[model samples]
Target: MAKNTYKQDEILEEPFDIRHLLRASSYIKKYQKRMIIAILLSSLGGAFGYIAPMITQHALDVAIPDKNFRLLFSLVIALLALYTGSIIFVTIRSKIMVEVSQNIIYDIRKDLFEHLQKLPFQYYDDRPHGKILIRVVNYVNSVSDMLSNGLINIVLESFNLLFIVIFMFLVDVQLALVVLCGVPILTVFMIWIKNKQRKAWQAVSNKNSNLNAYLQENIVGARITQIFAREDENAQIFQDLSQDCRRTWNTAVRYSNLVWPGIDAISVCVRAAIFLFGLVIFGEGNKSLGTIVAISSYASFFWQPIMNLGNIFNNFINNIAYLERIFETMDEPVTVSDKENAKEMPTIRGEVTFDHVAFSYDETKKILKDVSFTVKPGESVALVGPTGAGKSTIVNLISRFYNVDSGRVLIDGQDISEVTIHSLRSQMGIMMQDSFIFSGTIGDNIRYGKLTASEDEIRKASRIVCADDFISRMPEGYDTEVRERGSMLSQGQKQLISFARTLLSDPSILILDEATSSIDVQTEKALQTGLNAMLQGRTSFIIAHRLSTIRGCDRIMYIDDGGIMETGSHEELMAKKGYYYKLYTAQLEEVHKTA
Candidate 1:
């Protein structure tokens, strides 16, 4: 059995890899043209910004000193135009980027959901639902800005840094060289914290996933917890998980906080050195006041983009953890998907055969071994055994829920594995032990069996399964709305609704695995007549521990010890007094004792 809890530390830890980023770039390819246009607009805006320092120097040195009002006025007007153009470019770029990011997010989410639909039952059975959910929702949302605006900003900022350096040198090389000195120092600091920051953010991601998993699990099992009087215990567990999330978040923030201050310190020192050298050493009474002012402005401009780049880098490191998870889910192998060139299954005739099939969920133990059986068209076969004796496994194999480890499962004389899964399962009606009812009106839930079914068709099916009585007595009758998972309804009511749904589908084969276990004895008896009519022209597989329910089946197969030990009519099995007979008598004695 799968474990109920998955610890945070148990999640796989991945090293920092550039390949992840490279793979993510594939999503951006479709919007490359729009991205390029946005980058150009942003770069143009940045270019207008670079011209501001030069304008300042020209006004201070020539326009102001020459007492030329006309030149000064023109310069003021020109500066205003430059600022206006920059704002326009930035506005346009922001709009474009928002569209691109949302599109990328939609595409990614669509693909992830589609892939999830194809994954087999074992994949979900082995992992917590919350872990899978975080990848599809939270993780995907976290990476959207990074993949879209973040990529553009990286390019735009690098260009801004380059242009600032060039203009600084043109004004005066000595101060420019002093500004360059901080590069190596900042580079060393970044390298020192690179691995530490990445690992810390990865821990944060894991902790958050663990918290979500526990929260969802508790919410779903809240009624059980209250019944067991475990509120205090579960609360303590939640607190522990929340504490881990807080601790990891603080650690990651500490590493991220180092970047801004480090850049500021270097920026301050660089500005101070520019003054000392430009005036004391290189100045020597030769440096113009305007030259010093222009270089100073250039110095501030240069460091600004460096700081912005540092912030972008920080975001990349943090969101990379989320990105890895997103791609990891996308890259998960589809273990039970349609084969290449697989043919669509033709109309089913209700013939199912298992040819010496052997199966195992894991390598530890086999669930079914060398099991061979054939049920003719329109036959009703009952499977009964102790828990974990491959009763459900047998019905599940008939539906091809899991591929056989060896041999084959055939339907209508065709190997099921060679046919497309959609076409094969669409014709089969399966009602599991837990009948899941989606949130909708009563009529809508019943109509789920056949999307194109009419209202009359829905009522007919509900009547056949004996669900119409309770449904009609409800306040809104067929129009009554149900809460999520049909929490407002009784377990017996949910089973009845599920039965109506199965019947509405008009399937050629029906498999019921404890479908009526939750219903009261009276209700079960009342529905048996409708069930018998529904079973008349279709092959059926019924799995129940209540021997009385299966006594009327055409054949009863006692499944145990990895194969069928008894196969005969109910009377024949009773005469043999083997496994089936012993189990049936034991159940009767237990029922008598309870009565």
Candidate 2:
């Protein structure tokens, strides 16, 4: 198997941007009151946690030493009550965070999907579907834990760390200073680890995108693989992709896993040194047993938040990579947007004209050169050309799928670029060579053209396109389930359904781009008869493979090398003995050879 591999040299090494989190937070800003309450509750929990240790110090220093049983029992009850209150506060805060995070995720995903819808066709053409899907679905979810737990943890733990430091100094200044030393050391270590972890996560994300793209391609081309008997080869390639993803994911995990243990190790060393130094320097005469115990407890409490912070920081860094990918997609410029003063197209008269238009998908190659043409209302024009000769480009421009690089496309003598795209496209119908039939019943697919269409209208449209005969013969008769992309239907059947869909819209302008190329001879005659009837009194552009199909068209155009080489009726073009003549004769000879 020959595998095409690209270098994964772009590694993420930038420091996590606070602005990313700030932007994400903006979505949930409406719930600020609830978030504030949650943070307060978390702060309350941290404050309550100090009670148990304080009660212990008191019991050991005074109550037990003085043999006061009643005081000891009272302190025990206070200890239990304080710890229970802390648990309740944490539980309530977790609930609030969960709700806020879920709503924020929903808003973000909705915005992403809506933005993708508004993006130009060229945007989708340049990127794989799998990468876009990953950003919308997987990347949005990756930020959930960070938004939910990471946020509340950062606030509450900072307060907890502050309170612990204050109490440590109050207990013993020397021990407090020893505890503070671990802060800088751990902070430096985390900063170093963060850089490595970010790169690892970026690699993992890239690998996942590659794997998704590969899987999607293989699934769509499964039939081709089977036909070529290359299943084993393809499977090997998939295995390689999966292994690469797993390897990168493990690297990220390895770096993240180092965070907690490193924090805990420093914590242990700090505590050990505090105890040893306190005893060695300030003997038993200076520091009381209760004071030593209290200081040790305070030291652990101080380091505990730092340890928890280490875990939260790991999730924060991991999701930052996901946020970068997500925001990058969101920031994609919508190049083809309507002007601020764009007008809504009124009832269309369907007189389309292109004046000296030129277009190039890229700088190196031009798809359409300086071309000019006009189709009067109700005119049926057939565009006949060899492959890659700009026949489809002309139709695409009329529909405003791609704006012309130079010159103007006008409908009813009004520039299309000055009209709202939705209003302009509403009155037009386009059917491509590959008919896209989504998953649904036959009737439902037809009704998609006009959602307000009644059942009778659907059946009538099907009958007009000659699809009703085959549809009625099915087991369910217009109710038959068409699998995804209409896989269950023959090529002819899909084309008929597509025709039915287009015709049901009652469009003023219709485009058929090689629609009957894949259809059989018998189906083509039936389709042509129906189409010729429907095309009456409507502006139509037909791209035909069989030259014989365009004889009835009002005019025939022979396009070559991005220019119109010849234009006339079939009889006139044949009489001229030009490019159209040669093309028609070549096609006719080929048909005779097949016969």
* CA lDDT, every model vs. true structure: 0.87, 0.84
lDDT per residue as tens, model 1, 86-194: 9999999999999999998998899999988887888888888888887788878778889999999999999999989888888888777888998888788777776
Q: How well is each residue in 79-114 modelled by candidate 2, as lDDT tens digits? A: 889999999999998899889888878888988888
> Which candidate wins on lDDT?
1
Candidate 2: TM-score?
Answer: 0.92
